[model samples]
Target: MRLKERTIAIVLGGGKGTRLYPLTMDRAKPAVPFAGKYRLVDIPISNCINSGIRQIYILTQFNSASLHNHISNTYIFDTFSNGFVEILAAEQTNQTDTWYQGTADAVRKNLKHFHDQNADYYIILSGDQLYRMDLKDMLDRHIACGAELTIATKPISREQATGLGIIGCDSEGIITKFYEKPANDLDISEYKVADSLLHASLGKHVDASNEYLASMGIYIFNAKTMEEVLNNDKTDFGKEIIPDVIKQRKVATYLFDGFWEDIGTIKAFYETNLDLASINPQFNFYNEMMPIYTHRRHLPATKVNFCNISSSLTSEGSIITNAYIVNSIIGVRTIIESGASLDGVYCMGASFYETEVEKTANAKKGIPNIGIGRGTIIRKAIIDQNARIGDGCRIGIDDIPRQEGDFAMYSIHDGIIVINKNAVIKNGTVM
Candidate 1:
């Protein structure tokens, strides 16, 4: 049972990832790079493709140029196939003259696009999330139970439920209550899902410690239900739309016991990246069945002359000479000079290399070429794409430095020490 022809996935690239700070400084959150080889948007998009849901629409309003470029360059379907990865950028027209105000508003404005496709059901996805799910299975359950709306939910601890879209369902997997990030003291006794329902929903995959279900922000709606529900003035989903329809509609929850993380904030993003470097990573990049796709750089294998890299991922076209990198992700086209030490860092390598003439000009201006400098020590930091690290410089807790102010042209995020894209650093600098 495939929903390929009847389902069209809509991936919402949420407005400028304000929580992600420097990473979102110049690009949309979904466009932000992840796991050394792919962008955050690739997760949901890849999931859609792997599930045979190839007709994807990405909606973005903030810094969408980069996102557009990535999508355009990467996804190209054959002439006979109707499959495509298109971007519906927010626009102003005679009907309206404003940007997308919220999630519901964004889709409300673009309803015409989906209406033309006439898909029976629409799957809504978050572009900046990390997970792999088969929509066919979830849709199978949704259709079997005749649910008007279905939410993909994961079991979470009581403490973790306080900051998410908390769900409460009955014994038959039918939702009875929806709480959008309830306060710690909020009473939720009557809304809690029955233990039998949860155990039956997951069966052998049940976790005894998971007492609450948290929404993954992935919603599947019947086409008519979408039209009737979104034809309102509501601006958001978690805040307005879901709450308004739960009682009047047949809502249900689909249990997902996979590794899912919302990479919305800087801390969450940093932690998630570092987790990829763990020995037994929760989210493995080497999944052959459902591999995450990305724009191919077509570069050669990385060259390490005398560097020591352990539990780290180094992408293509990187050159590390006599350096030590531990538990980090070195992005594509990175060049780490001799004697540098990096620990728990995510270095988003340069997008392109500088020509010899460009390097000479950069040297004249006393700026380091796009990579870590000789003898530089960095730990627990994120180096954005095309960043330069000067020689003999120390970053991230080397001198017990908590200063977050810009060092040269770099920006800091909650002491994570981020060097923004295409920024430069001077020699012997410490932060």
Candidate 2:
């Protein structure tokens, strides 16, 4: 059978994104908006589609309404193609009534749904990540090595290894050991990559700082091997299944040299979004060969009138007038009134446009409309969907040191102010 026909991809929709709070307050981690228009889940799904692997299933649990809607509207396969992008949500059954305990458990519960796929290999992916990779290469390596399990690993420095699962591999690329998040005092020098392995992967001598191999949480398993490993009650792959299988099975590692960032925390998400507006970003979403796909709103073109914007990405259906925006992402349906200024901000625009009557009514009630008001100045902040920033407001631009915690209508995380969805910031407010 062909590679596309014999492989199935299962994307794990992450648990309640507590770290990405307010953003995840109303949606699943995978459903959270990304870049200017795409969702976090779109990255992996688009990678699958671009790589000719359309037999995809997303496993979701928490706040999956928006996720389900997005998948249904975005990824639709024709009957002739026999390709599909399906969702396998957590449900109650005779076997169990509890939610997904962990990553492994989520797949284990849905094994019955995948029994009819007849795929030779199952590729597991994380939904909340940013990277573009041809998964075919990893599967090819797995077949060439005759390995039951192949893990995608990234070379990282010692400083980056503290919070990630580190793997130890021999010269032949066989994983010898696995350590999950070793502490500062722990001696994991033995797990460092050998010079021979580093040269084989990168084709050059890399600095000793990038010695450790951190698991990218991307895995491909032989169909039978996946069943065998999930027979137990192991809840997590990185913590339990992977470490146990390395000893009993042939587990290999595939080195990924491309840029990959785990959008786990709010700070990481913020920085990653802002980086996309740079002159040259590490992760390019503009690749024609493997373009990232998302919901097609078919909205009108953005209307920028007398705006001094620099190095920013503005999506469709936006109207900016006499504003100064720099190094920011203006999302769909955004409206920036005259005299507004934004710097290093990600404004997730309104979901639905308000009519003139509605805006007038809101104004009479002393409420800001669903957009950035005139004379507002926001810096280093995330304006969520449908947020109403009143006139003359100053957010994140003040020199006052704000503690990292949730406040009324907004929160401070890593020095970035995040205005909640549909939050109403009164006029002349300063933060």
Candidate 3:
């Protein structure tokens, strides 16, 4: 059978992305707006489609309304084609009555749907990571090695290995042992990879530190092996299943040297979004051969009058007048009035334009417009969708507000202010 037809992808949409708070308040983490317009889920979905793997399933739970909306609105396949991108939510059954306990349990509970399909292999991916990869290349390695399961690994520093699944490998690039977040003094030098293995898997060595091989949380399973593994009561792949399998099965590693970010925390998400606006971005989204695919908004082009924008991205249907924006990302339907200044911010913009009647009613209610107001100064902040920042407000201008906690209206993390979705900043407010 052809390789393309023998595989299907399963994207694990995480449960309650609490790490990305306020952003995940109204929508699932995967549905949270990313890179100004695209959702976090689009990264893996676009990779799968571009890699010629069309048949897919997205397993999601916890506030999936916006996620379901985005998926349904986008990704329409041919009428007669077998290709599909389906969303699978956890449900109660005669045997089980609870939600998914972990990533492996999520797949184990849904294995019934996949059981009927005759695919040879299953590709597992995370929905909230940023990377561009062709799964076909990893699949070829799995098939060639005759591996029952293959994990994609990347070289990481000693400090980074404390929170990830670190793999121990042999000279032939076969998995030998697995460690989940080992302590600093545990001595993981036994797993130090050979130069030949690094050169063969990735074109070059990515880390000069070369302390450990961190799993990218990407997995490819031989269909039969997954059936055998999931038959047991193991709850999570990283903490339980993978460690057990490496000791018994034919497992290999596929190294990826490219840019990959796990946008799991508010700090990570905020920093990663701003990474796109850099002169030489760590992760480039402008690859002509494989651009990131997203739901087309069909909104009109961005409009600007006497605005000064540099090193920023403004999405469609935005109206900017007499605003100075630098090193920021303005999302769809955003409106920036005159005398406003934004620097090093990520504005998700409004969900929808407020009608004239709605505006009049809002005025009566004393609510501000769904965008930046006149004479406001915003710096190093994240303005969530449909946020109302009133006139003459000062956000992160003089006070960094460096914090690791959340307030009722917003959060200040790593010296950057994050305005929650649908939140209101009163007129003349100073934050």
Best-fitting candidate, scored by lDDT: 2
TM-score of each: 0.97, 0.97, 0.97
What is the C-alpha local distance difference test score of each model?
0.88, 0.93, 0.89
lDDT of 3 at 328: 92
Per-residue error for 401 in candidate 3, Å, reads 5.8
Q: Which regions of candidate 1 fall more than 4 Å away from where they truly are?
A: 404-408
- List of clashing residue pairs for candidate 2: none
The regions of model 2 sitting more than 4 angstroms off are 204-208
Tens-digit per-residue lDDT, 373-425, candidate 3: 99999998999999999999999887444566789889876666899999999
Span of ten consecutive residues with least summed lDDT in model 2: 199-208
TM-score of 1: 0.97
**Could you tell me the TM-score of candidate 2?**
0.97
**How many backbone clashes are present in model 3?**
0
Candidate 2 or 3, higher lDDT?
A: 2
